[model samples]
Target: MAGSVSPRFARWLAFAGWALVGAGYAFGVLSLMSIGVFVLAGSVVLTLLVRRAWGRGGIAGLVSGLGLPVLYVAYLNRGGPGWVCTTSGPAMSCTDAWNPWPWLAVGVAFVAGGIALQLRRPAAAG
Candidate 1:
């Protein structure tokens, strides 16, 4: 065994998550924020499973799981991004999305840290 779960189980879990995410988007059963949450949670779970199969990398999952919430909270605090504006033949429209650069930087840091943890080896005792 590698860490906690088997590779076949992980693969099946991923397949199920993909189907669930597809259904959520296609059916509009989930709002934008809900979709985001679902995707992030899926990402964390899948990454942890893969890392576990990779052996002794499960600890890094904690850091990896932190990526989304940190960035999201930062975006919320920054009031998200200003609306996008477009004009055509005197018609105008606008839309918005969170585009916080600093938040992204922090989120990447957490993700990178998790990857680093997975790469590190535990010390051997004499």
Candidate 2:
């Protein structure tokens, strides 16, 4: 996929991901979450960069971007996002988000699929 897709585009994506990672790490560390959303996005971008650099399975790049976070969040929550629809009281209303495991699973699937698709095809086939 390297020649198939413009190298400029791939390099740009890689640069964007790495750049975001740097910025997010700088400011995001101060937040309560210990990490910022930008950093996560950056990780995904990095993965995409690797995929792009390898020259194949462009879709996997996006899929990995989605999967990495899903897996991370799932790991943090220890399975899912925890209890949803939390009714605290009039003072405050809190609700948990959906489980990341499902999304993570889907991401893993896509990543694997992308890898499989990008496998070196026989030159004879061409």
Best by TM-score: 1
Residue 64 of model 1, lDDT score: 49
Give the alpha carbon lDDT tens digit for every residue of 37-70 in model 1.
6665665565555545433324454554456455
True-vs-predicted CA distance for residue 19, candidate 2, Å: 15
Instruction: Give the Å shift of residue 13 in candidate 2.
Output: 15
What would the per-residue lDDT of candidate 2 be over residues 64-83, giving only the tens digit for each residue? 34344444555555434656
lDDT measured at residue 11 in model 2 versus the true structure, 0 to 100:
44
Clashing pairs in 2: 1-55, 2-55
- Candidates in order have lDDT scores of 0.51, 0.46
Q: Give the TM-score of candidate 1.
A: 0.39
Clashes of each: 0, 2
